[model samples]
Target: MNTPLRRLATITLVMFVALMGSATWVQFFQAESLNTDGRNVRTLYREHGNARGPIVAGGEAIATSVPVDDPFGYQRTYSQGDLYSAVTGFYSIANSRSQLELAENDQLTGRSDQLFFTRIRDLLTGKRPEGAAVETTILPAAQQAARNGLGAQHGAVVALEPATGRILALVSTPGFDPNVLAVHSTSEAAAQYRALDQADGNPLRPNTHQERYAPGSTFKLVTAAAALESGDYQADTPVPSPDQLTLPQTSATIGNFGGGSCGGEQVSLADALRTSCNTAFASLGMTLGEDVLREQSERFGFLDPDLAVPMPVVESVFPSDLDQAVLAQSAIGQRDVQASPLQMAMVASAIANGGRLMTPYLVETVRAADLTIVSQTDPEPYSDAVSSATASALTQMMVGVVDSGTGKAARIAGVQVAGKTGTAQTVEGQPPHAWFTAFAPADAPRVAVAVIVENGGNLGNEATGGAVAAPIARAVIEAVLAS
Candidate 1:
């Protein structure tokens, strides 16, 4: 053969090999990701055409897929739309999915690997595969109580069963109705989503875990835990309780919430905690130094940027590089310290569960269409935030808060409640945020709850955590106890 002809043949051979390799990459490696992308019209049509499973809570379907005559074949519906929107989230063609709808999309759409045997059986029998039902850990009554507790306010409530880390209730007020976003018409759904996304107070976002704010006095729980865990201080250890003290190196003067002495010039750590004394904690925090404080905070799940309850939880952060003044302010739950209601609930849960911090979880079980259990969530401990002895001491101090201190509004009849109240001042001129975190039956805690009322509810700047946020925490605690 001529040299030029042989060269031409070699060039053609190389071109053919390259074409085959490209085709193989698209057919194998990129297949799953491209197929699963929500923006893929074919994938959307396929998922919407099938009968998706219902998401159950308290033995009732909170989210279901109903038949539709359109090409989509089904439309998702949330029975208690706004109440469970933060949990079930919305399954929409336009805006896609979130929360459980996003996390369990495979199982809900009957595509999970766990359903392989079922799919095989269906294929052999020439029958259609059915989606699996996701049973959530939510308690309807507790959820309702949380909703009513934060009624008309812009805030969030998170309740967890300490022993199991099962999220019982998660409520974010100024909630949007998920049904609006689940409509069959793509245009209508997109428009509704845009409206909610643009609404005041950000109704579309889940504030309970997705947003963070200064925890106010609710964070005293962490500081107290740190003090007790240090082995250098006991609950009754005498600490400074002056009414006012200037933060070190800065002219900023920190005082008690109402400008009164905590107890006296010097009081026990327990007494300072009961009173939610800013000066006491600030002084302690400064002494403990930023490294110790940050370690304690991170142990309770702060600074964990990717923490999630099966859904993304915004990082609850404690300021990193801090001087004495900044540490003092952060100790009082001010300065750069910010936390989500979910993180606060975890703090309370860690104390309630004997210092073993359980990993927060939402879904309890996943069952096939035939009611056969396919997957279940096992309870896991996230960390040992404090020793059992420290937890006990902190619990006693919190009990005193409910019994005779600022958290009195959280008291329940015939039940011992351990709680802390916080009134966090925001930027100049804005109302302080109200906060309350608690666990019930002090000796045998069954529930740990955190409630935050932004802009101080109806009382404006005069609202204190005990006056505004504690009552809400009480209601939720009672609901869980009663159930």
Candidate 2:
């Protein structure tokens, strides 16, 4: 062969090798990054191309996929629509996601490493690449109870097992049907979501853990726990009713819930918590000091976004200054302190479980359609927030609240439903939102619940958490207990 021809052949081979390297980089290494990019138009197309999985509850497909005629015509169809919107969330090509769909996409879509076993099986079975169906911890009865109990007012209900962190029902009022958002091509339907999102009141929160509110008197549980753990106060510790808590650092005073002082010069901590007395709580907070308060809050899963599920939680905002007044107001659940329904549920659960905070879990297990358990969430004890002794002390005080205090409306016949009530402050002209957190069967708590109602049922500032929120919690607890 001529020298020129040999040299030409060598150069051609080198160029070919470089081209193959570039192609491999783009296809193998860069494909996943490009596909998952937020702006990738082809992402939804690929999601549609895969054999999407079913959303099952009670062995029925509450949600599935069906084919249509648009460019990316296939879509997810929900049988129950609004009934499961907050849980299933909508998977729309036009609008990306919500609920479990947005958070658990990789798992449900079979793109996770955890899906390897199922992926291998599909390959051998000649089945198209598909994800395993998801099973929830929800009971249909519990879910219905949440929706029915809330009625026209906006609120949220979250119930979970005290022994186990399995979430039974999580419902937010004024929920949108997921079916509407699943149909991407229909402009009318998309417009409806926008309207709902921009509604006079926000319908998007689906409260669970996504929204924040002053826990009101419901936060007394934490203060009560802190007070008991401090050793400075026992259940019967004498907390004075000065009518106003004077700030130790600054000349400011914190008043009681309705500006009334505790009738007796000093009341027991048990009596104070049962009455949800603002003055007593402020005094207790001052006595406990700031570090103890902050430690207890952190132990209760404050600042941890994954306190339960992957939902958002407003951490307990501890005052930076240990100002006697700030501590007092915070103890009463006011002046910049906030929490979500989910967070309060954890508090109730910790109290119910003898001071152990179990990480809240929404999914019971991830199983294939054939009932094979592909993955399951082990009931994990997230943190030891307090001691069993503290739990007992708090439980007794909570029971008193339901039996003889502000939470009288939540009383159940023959069943011990320990609870706390909070009538929180709202804007000047607005009635406060009612708040309640509880766990039933004082001796052996099975369910922990947190409920909140917006604008005090439109009752013109007459609303108390016991009157508006506790009843809803009672009904939900009854439903779960019955199950």
Maximum-lDDT candidate? 1
lDDT of 2: 0.80
TM-scores, in order shown? Answer: 0.97, 0.90
Residue-wise C-alpha lDDT for candidate 2, range 35-89, written one tens digit per residue: 7764675888888877567776656777787777767646788887766666777
Could you tell me how far off, in angstroms, the CA of residue 113 lies in candidate 1 after the best superposition?
0.9
Clashes of each: 0, 0
The alpha-carbon deviation from the true structure for residue 170 of candidate 1, after best TM-score superposition, in angstroms, is 0.8
Residue range with the least summed lDDT across 10 consecutive positions in model 1: 243-252
Weakest 10 consecutive residues of candidate 2 by summed lDDT: 307-316
